[model samples]
Target chain A: METFADSLDTPSVVVDLDLVRANIRRFQAYADANGFKVRPHIKTHKLPLIADMQIAAGAIGITCQKVSEAEAMVAGSSAITDVLITYNIVGAEKLARLAALARKVRLSVVADSADVVDGLSRTFAGEASPLRVLVECDTGANRCGVASPEDAAALARRIAVAPGLAFGGLMTYPPAGGEAAVQDFMSKAKALIEAEGLTVPVITSGGTPTMMHAAEAPVVTEYRPGTYVYNDRSLVMRGACGWDDCALTVLATVVSVPAANRAIIDAGSKALTSDLLGLTGYGHVLGRDDLAIDQLSEEHGRLVSTGPIGLKVGDRLRIVPNHACVVTNMVDEVYLIEAGQPAPRKVPVAARGRIR
Target chain B: METFADSLDTPSVVVDLDLVRANIRRFQAYADANGFKVRPHIKTHKLPLIADMQIAAGAIGITCQKVSEAEAMVAGSSAITDVLITYNIVGAEKLARLAALARKVRLSVVADSADVVDGLSRTFAGEASPLRVLVECDTGANRCGVASPEDAAALARRIAVAPGLAFGGLMTYPPAGGEAAVQDFMSKAKALIEAEGLTVPVITSGGTPTMMHAAEAPVVTEYRPGTYVYNDRSLVMRGACGWDDCALTVLATVVSVPAANRAIIDAGSKALTSDLLGLTGYGHVLGRDDLAIDQLSEEHGRLVSTGPIGLKVGDRLRIVPNHACVVTNMVDEVYLIEAGQPAPRKVPVAARGRIR
Candidate 1:
């Protein structure tokens, strides 16, 4: 029998629905048993259908990285009533959109600096409901957020006193293998915030690699895991999830068998993405561990064989890309593969290109 | 007076229409003077409006990488009559789409293997007009193409004798400094094919780095240059075009100034892309040679300064990415900056995700 995956075109994203639900239930069950709220990041699978599935499986809310992404999720389904934008919201246009989205849903934003908080204050000063704000602590990520617990406390105090803003808590996206540091950082920040006569209702820390050990940080009230819904090669390499748990795979055809050792596929950087994530090569070809995607142009993926390979043109292969979040943003539609279905149903990546 | 670019959102693609026209005319003029046909690759801009502009400036046709992309261009505008898909067409779905598109326009495709040609021949066998096919030859890129002149001749002969196929000629995407080898390979292939009583009408060779030296190869009758329309940092590094010749820039906002020398922008891999292309960092921060975009997540670009920088929160910066072709594919829309316009006109990237 021809499966739904077999009927799709080359260079398409095929998501196994069974694996998606299983991954979601497993993560949600872990979070539930650990007394932590699960706010799944929608950036991994930028689809409302998947977000709805996450919410139905006992998620507190959905975490988005951009205002437009939050808006797309809210517009796609009413189940996403609570949204936490994890990026520093800046500029008048984005602030206005943020304010409008806050009016429609329980919206909260993160800010590492006072300028971002000031912008939020000016945008929502006279609104009926004050906007919730979280001070982002660095927690060893060294990317965004305040450096020390003192800075986090100061930013939280600033957000507390800002007009039409409520200091929600502290949030951090720690680096991989920095769970111990995150625990120490968040504990110190929580103590500092409590010393200032403020209650830290929520201390959220997240990273796919450190998600399993999230409970090790006693101060964290919630965990936001994005890649768990659709595990990728990066997650597999980090030992966060096994290879069999990967729900998403890019279906591609070997368009050209140029030589005995080199086969080119239709998927390229535009499909699989160029986010190496400190890994060598591009992606892992399923059922062909010997073949490595050595190179990629915009529209062609070069798969090189480690040994003699019997691949030919027109042969189809599925690849687990290094990073699934960036790949989700690359395509407008993805195929949903369900067991016993005649064909995979096409779902619009509703939040794709919503990188405002 | 604020310019159109100043009034728009951050992390958006701002294309200077004047520079786009100038770049198109400059390359077309060079190709015209040197007796080479100009078939601008639509994968760079992916907009029918830009494709129409290239055709108006004297391009013989447009080159596409996928069947869906060609379909989008042909459906968007009537100016794109001739489309040369430089990738091999495979599968029943894509072959049917290729046959349908061939009926609408002057369509031709390239194949490096017998399987691809056989699929194309099977799809177009009973059609009124035979589909044109070109044998893609490997001139040293070693990505996708026939191995040698002998293989190229054999594929050309197979394509010529196929039921509903016409041998167009030879095509290649030569490596950046491989002009001499391309000349040698194409000349020998042309002679071999001619010995079999087949006319090599179009010997198409292209690459932005080797575009200026394309005329050095006497056998190449046509050139397809994609990134020349919006020159990037890679092109600048190769001495193909100057920094001032670059027409595309990603307008990003400094969302947070965490430290004295560290600034974070709202654009990341989703905007700038992760195509290092053998260069360090993500992109060239325009006007700030002292700053480097050292890291990128999905929505955050980390700019670390080599010295004391004057940039602050909410300040905007323009970046010239390393690869313009991949960056263009990441966005759904781009702002067109025309002279004297109060607001930059927004145009949908008509063929953004047509990776079928």
Candidate 2:
């Protein structure tokens, strides 16, 4: 008998719009009740359709990592007018692109150094509107931020006086489970900036692992969580969401059952991605947790079990990948099972390959 | 001061055409002297230009892991005719695509089960020409293959009698440093199939790690290597290629120097992939191995050192990623540094996101 999923090619990403809607509503409610604004990061889904859904569900804005992504998102959707790119963007070519993107959306960016500030000021010096620049704080994440709150204040002061730049506020991708650090660092930075006679408009903090505890950092005026809309095994392992809450899964087919304990699926690192994120296996096989996805080549996934891996050839399985963000970036089109739609609709990943 | 590399956006892949030509010429010469057919796998560069260079250097067609990759490679280049898809083309959608691809070129695929053969037979039962099918054998890779030589012979016989299928040969993605096993298993399988009055015309073995020792397995007729065109840190560590021979390098700009020991680059997992490949760092920073690419978020790569990290914001660095194949798939366009040209040329990654 023909099935609803037959239209989708195997090793393709399948995102349930119902789960996405529920996830967006749940997180939006949590953020609203907690007195924090939700700015869903489009890096996880990389789709303008879901960004529109998040906005429809009362999200304040969307977050993008690159100017190209912001351009693609704003061009693809009619609702996403605000975008915050949380990175220290350097170089002239990207700065011009950033200036062009700033003209389209209410743009804000993060910076941790004088070089990035000067570069931005150089590009946007003569623009009609000043660029909103945020001071990125460490907050114990140690990825891209200033070392201390003093450095954050210093950067904030630099941005406030830079040509064609306005000191927006503070931003940090805080360490997972480090709400106290976020509260401590951001509060200190806000105090320092206030003492400098500058008003910190919006303090932004991002990360899916600490979205629930975002209220702990009361100074954080906005919450940016990318992965909650399409939670994966990493988020589930951290108790951020349940298995049923996962919106994105790789739809694969069993092409080889070579042994009693081994079965091979058509999906591999190319489809599922190689982002382990401290997970033992590649993904959580939906209904087959007993089976471990042991290894992945570019085009083959090895599923092994202690006993008979009861899977046969042509059997289909859905894998919630290790990192949903990276998985979505691997494919061109994702199969969407939207609410009220009987069949899966294929949607192109609009912001894919916008790494620059 | 402005430089020639200024035209390139930060976190962009740069492929040196000079090095690619040299690498392809060197490998093709080695294969010629060893009397083995070099069917260069296009997964690493994913560019038809490089594929054309490989063919000009006397490669026997190209190797693609998916139907879409094959389609992109064939469509982009004018000099390609033969293609080999080293994967079990499963499901009706892909089978139909595979059938369509076969009509345009000399196409062949590998399978390890009767089910895969049946799927192909059902799709191409009444085609004008029978599809070429190779029995995938297990030479200790333990990923996707029939278990033993006897199983290989049985599958070969199954394909021999299947309608609209011709038993072409045998293929295996053997384990690294397992040339003896490839010789032992493939020889035994060939003898068994020949005893059954079936001709095993071509015996294919693939893997970049064991490409140099491919001739130890005298029964192998073709050697497929994907990573030789652009050697990465993994290949350099394995003594396969030197650092200077690496054709592809991620051109990134230092966005933050957070501390004396920490710096951050614009490239992250979205630019440089998270494929560790058992390496200590995400990539090898050109001329600065002292800095370890400690961590990667979506758009930030943290570089840490034990002592004073002299890097400043706005400084440019090129990284030879841990795995070049995965890195090429992360972006849509790459900067090409041709030999005669003074500046870099932008080229779209034509076969990127061809996972399906």
Candidate 3:
């Protein structure tokens, strides 16, 4: 009766807030020990409650990817003063929004070019205050940012002299190649930016895969790792975090035991997002690695198990999704479970669907 | 400002309701000519307005994938009197919910076993009315359902005799390879069910791909195609609909022209829902087919083109996401465009985050 196993309601997202708090503490401790500032990315959790917890755990600030996400967080807590938007702010309207946000908090953003620099300059010109800007370096991701240190330095110089703008430093998302390359690139960029007579004080770089190694690298002044708070199947596959370290789990109900080897859960792609991301399957069933959640309908998760899982109809199972960040955006609320508790505290995912 | 090209927001879901209406009319016309009831699945749009439009245009009822979706739709309108859930109803809790839903509307569900039948029977035995059930056949998408026609017929027989249960008919999600085989099996199963003196009224079969072909197939009395209303990149790839027929698009801003050939948009896995389903990339840029949206960060979409796209800062583009259903789940509201206009009537995706 206490379990949600008997419920037939499909396409709902379930969260364990207790696990989220533990994750926050763990990541905070890691950052504290490494002498790097912890700036938890709100892009992963998207909940204001989770963001508050991260800040409460002694995080320097929150890292947001969108202006809307930043706006949502600002609405939740004016106390969260320092926020770094880890995305390129281009376009007139977006820069205007960014400029407005900058007026409220200690706002900083990443950029990769002169056009982006010009866009920000035009939007923030003649303002009483200015927006902090970081020149994004490619760092082998080959996706965004300047490919070379020279390009980064060139942008940094423009940012240093641009009206209503301050050059914060350099930023990059290292592609799983590791710390040596990122450190090398950051060092060259920092030297180049300083050579251009601008202070590159805040060097930021860290992804879930590079978190452990990022602490060992000295050039990065701040590390922002989001997924360490919710170690998913993808993070586990990459050896980023242990299964025990995974704090977020999708609670689902077994709605059908159609075949001896096959069972179906009410939670599907709609609940646990079908983002396999090169993984073998949709998600990993907690405590049952042998069971494969092989197929996902939008509302029904097709679970196939060769072993005796002793799973029956109406049994509630917790699933660790392949990617947790995308899953956070799909729901409006989440539950925070305290230790040894029957009921978790209900908290609204206030920023859940702020996709703009 | 008239064209969607001038929108201010990035990663926005733009639906051409005109195209959606046209698709609905086309499907309704096909179903009317072919003598099959059109039960348009609400899983595609997750919009009650669209579902109501389909019903107004001659849909007999509607198909809901999730209990929450069905509950929301039923709550929204009194005109939608009948709903057929195209999923297995399992577990005591879900059965009770299903029973409660049956009280308000003529509810029908699909199942593949005696356990589910027994669960439904037990839950609805004392109710004023009985629950209608359909035995799901493993037509082609070997994801779920009974493997043999004999098993399906036996399950149907059990539903007929069980208290508070009525055997409706057979249902199948037609996979590409086994349409003919499924037709042969369903024909035999229909005969077997009829021989048992049971009313097998609703023989439902068809997905978006085989929807047209299913109408001509033997023993398919109803067609339930979800994605025809909003043709996606995947559907276009399958040749079910052309690019012009695509009703759904994700409007995004070009956030970064990082390199000459590569640009990054503010939309990524969060906006596009990383449900690749074996397509080459996340989405197809409206005017640039050669530009492949090959990489996705949580909030950044990396577009790779052979040459410079002539894209600059402040440029907005519409992208047809690889999958529309998953995209709908990511946003709180969507704009209903008449002719791809920037200022379109905004429609709330009412059940946007109703996962469970």
Record all residue pairs in model 1 with backbone atoms less than 3 Å apart, i.e. clashing. Answer: none
**TM-scores vs. true structure, each candidate:** 0.98, 0.97, 0.95
lDDT of 1 by residue, A280-340 (tens): 9999998888989999988899999867667888888889999998888999899888788
Per-residue lDDT of model 1, residues B68-150, tens digit only: 99999999999989999999998989888888998899999999988989998999998999999999999989899999999
Q: List candidate 3 segments past 4 Å from native.
A: A1-22, A307-310, B339-342
Q: Write the per-residue lDDT of candidate 3 for residues A114-199, one digit (tens) a residue.
A: 88887788888878887889988888888777989888898899998898888889888787746887789899988987786778
Report lDDT (Cα) of residue B345, candidate 1.
88
Q: What is the TM-score of chain A in candidate 2?
A: 0.98
Name the top DockQ candidate: 1
Write out the backbone clash pairs for model 3: A6-B93, A6-B94, A8-B94, A11-B355, A11-B356, A12-B355, A12-B356, A17-A336, A18-A337
Pick by DockQ: 1 or 2, better one: 1
Per prediction, fnat is 0.83, 0.81, 0.72
Model 2, residue B136: C-alpha shift (Å): 0.6
Consecutive 10-residue window with the lowest summed lDDT within model 2 chain B: B1-10
Please give, for residues B115-135, the per-residue lDDT of candidate 3 as tens digits: 778888888889998888999
